[model samples]
Target chain A: MTQATRVHVAVPNAPYDVHVGEGVLQGIAAATAGADRVAVVSDREVCALHGDLRRHGVDAPMLEFDGGESIKTLGVLEEVLDFCAASSLSRSSILVAYGGGTVGDLTGMAASLFKRGLRVIQVPTTLLAQVDASVGGKTAINLAAGKNLAGTFHQPHAVFCDTGLLGTLSEAEYQSGLGEVIKTALIEGEPALAQLESISRDLGARAVTALSDTVARCVTTKARVVVSDPEERGARRSLNLGHTFAHAIEHAAGYGRVPHGIAVAVGLQLAASASERVYASSTDLGERIGRLLSAFGLPADLEELRSRYSLGAALTANALIEGLGHDKKGRVGAPEFVLMRGPGDIELGVMIAEEELRDLLA
Target chain B: MTQATRVHVAVPNAPYDVHVGEGVLQGIAAATAGADRVAVVSDREVCALHGDLRRHGVDAPMLEFDGGESIKTLGVLEEVLDFCAASSLSRSSILVAYGGGTVGDLTGMAASLFKRGLRVIQVPTTLLAQVDASVGGKTAINLAAGKNLAGTFHQPHAVFCDTGLLGTLSEAEYQSGLGEVIKTALIEGEPALAQLESISRDLGARAVTALSDTVARCVTTKARVVVSDPEERGARRSLNLGHTFAHAIEHAAGYGRVPHGIAVAVGLQLAASASERVYASSTDLGERIGRLLSAFGLPADLEELRSRYSLGAALTANALIEGLGHDKKGRVGAPEFVLMRGPGDIELGVMIAEEELRDLLA
Candidate 1:
């Protein structure tokens, strides 16, 4: 068992720890030590691949369902909450979310609303979830109007990111997580970005040690930002370095067509390009990030993204810009864009003129 | 225009003032001063009677729906959220919940969930709402399973309790509000209780000054308790004095049939009786409370409640106890009961044996 690296998220009122390593799944026992009742909600595929709670000697009820972006809806969220109610889970109970981002999102939401709120432990199974989704306290469900249009800031009791679980991810899915890793590394600046650039090949090969270190770094950066701005009121918005464009791209290409992390990869490049134009900075930030993303065999440009996903006319610049109007983070026409001056020098709530945005998209 | 009394609810992270007076509705403008957009969700009846946002010189879009316990469902809550989204309410915007408890519950729940939470200014139009629901940060929407089964602790930006609005309440509705008033007074003890007893005649006659003072007193008690324990983990349970039994009674008697406050009046009597038996105290506390409730024309006993609501065998002790199993505050078998040793001395999480509870109900 590889030694797990722990990152403490100091969110006010509900501070918790994140464990990242090869066999860190074993940490679940300690995380839920004194919980009167523990309910594990997992993706059926993940459960099939890596046994259920009993594998860790936990005698608790488990709910396994098909997990994906599609399941992040109010209906599915209600189903999860119903399962919680049926399991007779109480306030003192702990709910373990065992899956990718979708399962964690649904379970976190259910935990927040069930009897006004309950403790939740996240066991993220995917790379994207481990590096980003699992660390943030933002839990959401997509509405017909937009993705993650409705959500709550319900922090987890703990997060366990087992690098060993990444072995089962498909190559494309693995690359999807690398998208968020690059985004996090960019936002983190310094050694994190340098480290990611150096270990790009090892990460692509699914090296457990590399993955664990990267996850720990990402979580540490996220935790610091979250502690400073738990509600995303100020400094936390910087974490959305590439999310504004990524969400728009995903919406234009139709959700689930372009994996979120992949879209984020393209978004990171877009942000870098916009930064160069907006700030006129004499930095090769865009080219450097592009090279790093390309090294991991991910799309780093809009043209590449469109070709890779077979997203032809659907992902047009206008459609992507139109989709921005629905971003949960922004108001109607003047959507807040997170622009980059360089690594660690990210600007939040930057309002680019419509024509400037249009020119960049074109 | 009576002088408005401000009760500051010092909940952590988001503290707000509750303004109680005859024309306090006019305070809406200042409560939502810097909000870029203000969306008013009101009861249609209340809107027709008291006029809409225009009356307060606020130019905001309004969604007026029929407000009742039945409308406190996820569907209505969703409509309210959709309305918010349609109104383009951003994080900086304010949502004014203008109605009774149902409207407040639904609107507050929506405000907490939309865009991960927005500012909400509660303009409670009912005495029950003014005294209890509006002051507390408990936002909820009922599920098919139970009342307030899904909720969040999203404190309002401010609360406007216009005593003038209570003039429109029916005799039964006014008495229902008095039930909560009596419960609040008992929990508060001393001057609050004494003041209520003294002003009983004036309050019953809808005297504005009396109503304002009572509302302010109740809010003060609630505010103090909420400030000490915002999340209902410890001392906050004391506020749930009659709620455990009250919820069970409502469940067995069927919701909407017995107004919440009336059910609470009966529940208070049951609690007082149970306290006597459990603590073996010889205080005529139950009788005194019974007399006070009787003076307000609220049912003080199960027989009177049965006669008042024409509720037959549906309110059996066994059924009510069964309902207790589903109390959100307790475990399945042993529901937490708040028993009182005296007016000020309230005990929380008291576990009464099933037989003892049955005997008390009998």
Candidate 2:
């Protein structure tokens, strides 16, 4: 992809570009001209897919780890540290995360820690990562306690979102990305929702041209919000409109069993329903959300997920509610929920009381 | 002790106050007025010395971990993450790192990771931490590969350097701080060296009032350097002048065999000697440096360290040379060394040859 189809991710002092296109990875070497050494941290599969990244002005040894949610941990992070120190990766060196969000999160953290924040470039391969994880400075590794329990806000020096990688993704993974794209569309207000509506079928059909435009739109929306509130004080929390419930669903259903984007789709439906019921929000966004989910070929019906995960069961409900309280964006006791008001508006930091939350599933 | 001694550390985006006084820790509650909750991470020793920080506006639970340089590891950092999660520490929550440099490093890292950075306040108890680690936003945890191999730069919301804490230190522990004090004095140039000369007798005798002014001057000097180059691009690397040889000496002597300050005292002596040799422009700053070390009650003789650590041996020389290459501020081949030009001036980033380093002890 060309730099022309790029969005400037304004992270205040550390602004960077998120380039979306085909053959974009080739530009990484030029982008990291000042880096004395470039170290690529990717998974074995991705490394196989995109041959040795050492040719890209990288003298240091590459660190390839096992992929998936299970691999994101402090143990793996330690291994990353050992590789860096052994390779003698200095502050002048740059770490290029050449995989999906899981690899990006792990590598980003290693860069931040190794010699107190080295320059990092996010080369997101998965659709879920390219649109969502690329722009935001959120880098994390899951702990036994919870997902994203150990992480920091380390913005990448630049992000290379090459849509060419989508050609190799499985149908399930591709659909997973559509879930987040739908979520982003809802957050972007009416026009984005309309654009998403027009492109959903093309996206479902895997049209290459449609993929590029969709990725750019989602990235632009995310960049605008993150720039306005990088630290998630108020406005940025709106981006987590469905994430409060999504995290709980992921935890209960078990991570990776159901992809994060799919869970976010379900959570957005939950948010629309809750917003309509609790606030009597003038617009009935739930119907529109359901249609969007269907159009994107996602699991629009909660009945299937509820039955599968047993949402009515005490254990599952408790896990969901407990997860909400531990949601990093919300306060400890008073958990914040983002409720929709149709189109471009969503009320962030709306605290849902225990009773309302208890009956949320019902 | 009063607010007059406070130094404002201008760290670009994250400016903070370093309050130094007798009972300054008492004002912490007022300082963190906007904090919804304050959770302290300190060892039993600091807790006993400072008492429960809850009295200082920390209503949240305290996370007390094992103390020492050994405690600076990812495993302990994970435990810290658990504590923050269990405590349900939101983005709004404040983390008070109470103790020495080790505690500050670990806690500061945890603060940066937990919810992508909480408002961290550095309450450094040791003299070394107060004068040095307090200003720079350098937070780290050690890995098996090396010391400070894993870390990130997370600036504290504020730093409370209460000289009152220095009163509780053991003779060795108190003297450990003097190493950094002397190093700072040298970095500050002739005026600070003169100040150290003036106060050395009172400080050597363990007079408390003299400790306050010395700590303030060192903090101010560090603040000026860190504010200009927080990431150690150029002038900031000068801070590691003595540290390069100091690391080698420490590794050769074995950690804790020669305390950090003692090694620094020796390292400063080495820098002065090396500068005199290589530069040849004429200045016996080494003699003045030796006297300054004696006045500060630090080990002035490299011969003592060399004899004790068996420096003439291949193992020690190799370790010292190996350690110099790994110096954080310098590249692999071109290791940076800070050398003295005159009283208030110093030449930084001087590359010493291998043969010179090999025969350094001889």
Candidate 3:
């Protein structure tokens, strides 16, 4: 809490800051000085837990929504839009998202949509968001068909990730967030992979030092990739390592039932196995990912996840595979994936054969 | 039909060409040569009138929606998204919006939101969409509370304006588009204003040469302004010249009843009147605008429109005045007006006092 960790993501069109520390609300107040109107949007839980944003001195209206994964829908988006209109929120108005990734996603999309976009200050309050959502400008909601099927790339004006917000997160949420941290560690390579591999256990326990540093590291890693490819056309997809399989798992689980991090953790295993078969190497990459996930209380085995979710039948596996093809990241009839070559090297846009993928699924 | 007029809009972030001609469907085919997937989105009316896009040699799926004004809602947006998902429309898909501004607006927004945006080709059949909506990248849907309360600025990859399509447009719809063409001409200052004024009479009769040239000219004028300021940070506000007052008129008429172009036509006179009252000049700008509008079979007098829409007393005028204060372009208290000093000359962001504005309303 004494030291502040800051990361800057240069999206070219919209560069923003990601701050990790305690008592950072005052910093946000200073950044949004000349704004005509300031509005804070958050979920009901976060609003109740954090109280009103007015506590920071800059007075503004607090907009709250209820529900979890269900909130990421067009119906809910309209509700937020209606709230803005009722409050007379204009282009000059500033919107500060005061919750997790879902809140950030919904608010960011609203900011990008309302009058083509308003300046949004992302105040992500969850470990999952602090590392991932708060850094990249990807904002979206779930379509009835799938998660994040409907969305836009809208970068926030600034992202204030107060690590103090992590103290209140339940054990399950914190563990779920570790899935993304592990993904970042694995993708970044070398020093980070070695460092994370060493202290994966302590970080799972929410040790202040480990948690803050890991958060800053993940943000920094993602920022470097995002700055180079803001629109997800190239290197940015590396950030989605194991996400193709993960999206299918979430889709099959009916979204939120298996939290995003859990799905991603499971996705990394599938990706590792696919990598093992494709690369024709027995590098123990899958085994290392399994060990790291286990230390964090995450399910890493494909069989274990399938059993937990009752996903055994060929039909179910085929359906999940179908979801992968439907993912936004891939071109039609050309399903590509992000896979790990070894401990620290992640390869992007590796085309996977359908039958080969089927053999792995089986 | 032989010679196509091309206007290139330099958006810096994403530049595009606006091609105008009678038989330019072949040009559209050439533009979309290597696209992975081509899809046409339109209302049933356009689909029926235009027959099919296959005549241009590019066969693609046609997505349709029913209803008017009301179609520009979240319910419809979700439907279009569902269509994209069903069609497996991914990041590589090319969406051709082959209808009026509403279709272009809705489809452009869908393209922008679908996987954070796809390459959109705007084939504006209606004049309004051709000159304004398709050119500036301004996409929005009317909120129940207000018009364009929720929207985004997503530019199309290309725009094709087929003058031949105007053959099928109802007279009301065609004339309705003139409001925008007039607004652009007034703002462009010069030859555009003089040229439009000269051909005002024949153009009203659907003169092909006049319509095509005016369409090309208007597109060029808007492109110049958009290139300088793509996000409406400055000069782009001039495009909304007659739009502020027009929004109030449409809102009063319950939208679609008065028609956007008629309201804009009425809005122009109000803007001209306000300009006279504010500038304290002896310029004959208002009279020239009136003369031009009259030749096009448009009502040139404010009293004529007020009578037509049955707007009377201080209450209705005051209500619209209030709506101006709420405009996204100007600040909450001080509403700015875009006015013209003379032919080929415009004064943008002209702030008017509430009392003086009331005098015009009175």
Which candidate has the highest lDDT of all? 1
Tens digits of per-residue lDDT for model 2, A264-293: 888999898888778765565778878888
| Clashing residue pair totals per candidate (backbone < 3 A) | 0, 3, 3
Worst 10 contiguous positions by lDDT, candidate 3 chain A? A308-317
lDDT of 3 by residue, A1-362 (tens): 45588888878866888888776666888877878877878777876787767767768777887636878989889988877776677788888888888999999898888877888999888898998987788899988777898888888888887777788888778877898998998888868878998888778877777878888899999899989888888889998888988888777666777778878888898999999888988877788888988898888776777776676652266877877776778887677899888766878889888888888766
Output the number of the TM-score-best candidate: 1
Better of 1 and 3 by DockQ: 3
What's the CA error at residue B21 for candidate 3, in Å?
A: 1.3
lDDT of 1 at B204: 84
TM-score for chain B of all predictions: 0.98, 0.93, 0.95
**Which stretches of candidate 2 lie above 4 Å from their native place?**
A1-4, A49-60, A282-284, A308-315, B1-4, B48-60, B308-315
CAPRI verdict (incorrect, acceptable, medium, high) for model 3: medium
Worst-scoring 10-residue span by lDDT in model 1 chain B: B141-150
Expressed as tens digits, the lDDT of each residue in B1-362 for candidate 3 is: 75689898878778888899888766878877768888888767876887667778768887876535777899888988888877778788888888888888888888889888888899888888887888888888878777877777888888989888888877678777988888888888878788887888778887888888888989898899988898888877888888888887777667667778877987898888887777777777778778877776666765777776576542276777766755667654566778877655677788878788778766
